[model samples]
Target: MSVETDKIEIAFEQLVDIQNTIDTVLKVPKNPGHIGVRDMLRIIIGPQTDSDQEKLSEISSNFLARRQFKALLKSQTLASQTKQAAASSKTTSGQVRRSGDDFDLNLIPSTGDDKLFYMQLKVKNHERFAQISKAEMLFVESKGVFSSVPLPEILDGVSQIMIRQGHPVLDAFHDPEAEFFIK
Candidate 1:
């Protein structure tokens, strides 16, 4: 692996070590399931560093402030990712890092396969997305635990399977008598 690849992996490890907040923050790979308020609370209150927790809070506040974040936060589950299919991520266009929104300089080191299983999984996901008429989620396999390129906070950068029905999990987070569905 290149020096750059090593650096990206280290950064990814830093994120994984902190907490599995990426899924919750990004609200992707929804991983079909149901968790009651009790379980949800446990995850949000689980073992995470103070700084990590703060980073999660800041992330929600910064990009997703417009949404009902408290409700969303309450809806968080301790779920791991399940396979989903979606479109591909954009690649580097040039040496430039930012060409408006998309990263033109997606300088992650190349590798033939991270592991055979993961590579097959990635290939299957890509193929599955191609078949789905309206694919909402994508199982993005980075170069490895550390991707070859630096991944940024993908808020509006990536399109998702937009669930406009007002998050199903978040419904449990709300007070039954207080909040109504949708604004």
Candidate 2:
């Protein structure tokens, strides 16, 4: 099944770009949760840093301090949102689950240059169905009419997944070779 997406979220896009950068320059630890920030300058800025801790300490503090501690403040807001999610999240059966993956629906544009992607959609009425539903081919929206694109084999010896804003994704982010992972 194919679904029309809501507007593409810019904040989410920015987050994705930031993650793409982090995953490019750092080393991925075998375990997860965090990247090894052995050299703060190298991790945050890049390898061409001055390699002087005292200077980097100032830069780091400035980055944290600018605009009234914006990074920390933004994190506080995010923390609160998750805190509230637990209470607001409820299903008819019991607790609500979050499947935060970005690719439930796959939207393809007419061509590669197209900015809009076709993907699965969430509708107003069908939010609470606890089952797996599959379709032979997916609905594609373009040219004022719907077309069809067969779903590609999702996992063909490729790293076929990433969790948005999740810790496990850190591994994928740091592996430069993972850049080619299928969306």
Number of the top TM-score candidate: 1
Off by over 4 Å in 1: 1-35, 48-70, 74-89, 92-112, 115-183
lDDT of 1 by residue, 73-150 (tens): 424411112222322233463111111111111212223343111111111223333332132222111211100111
Question: What C-alpha lDDT do the candidate models reach, one value each?
Answer: 0.28, 0.28
Question: Poorest 10 consecutive residues of model 2 by lDDT?
Answer: 78-87
For 1-183, candidate 2 gives per-residue lDDT tens digits of 123232346667888999999997795666422223343323222333343334333333443322232232232221111111222223454322222222222122223453433332221112321111221222211111211223333332111221233222222222222211111
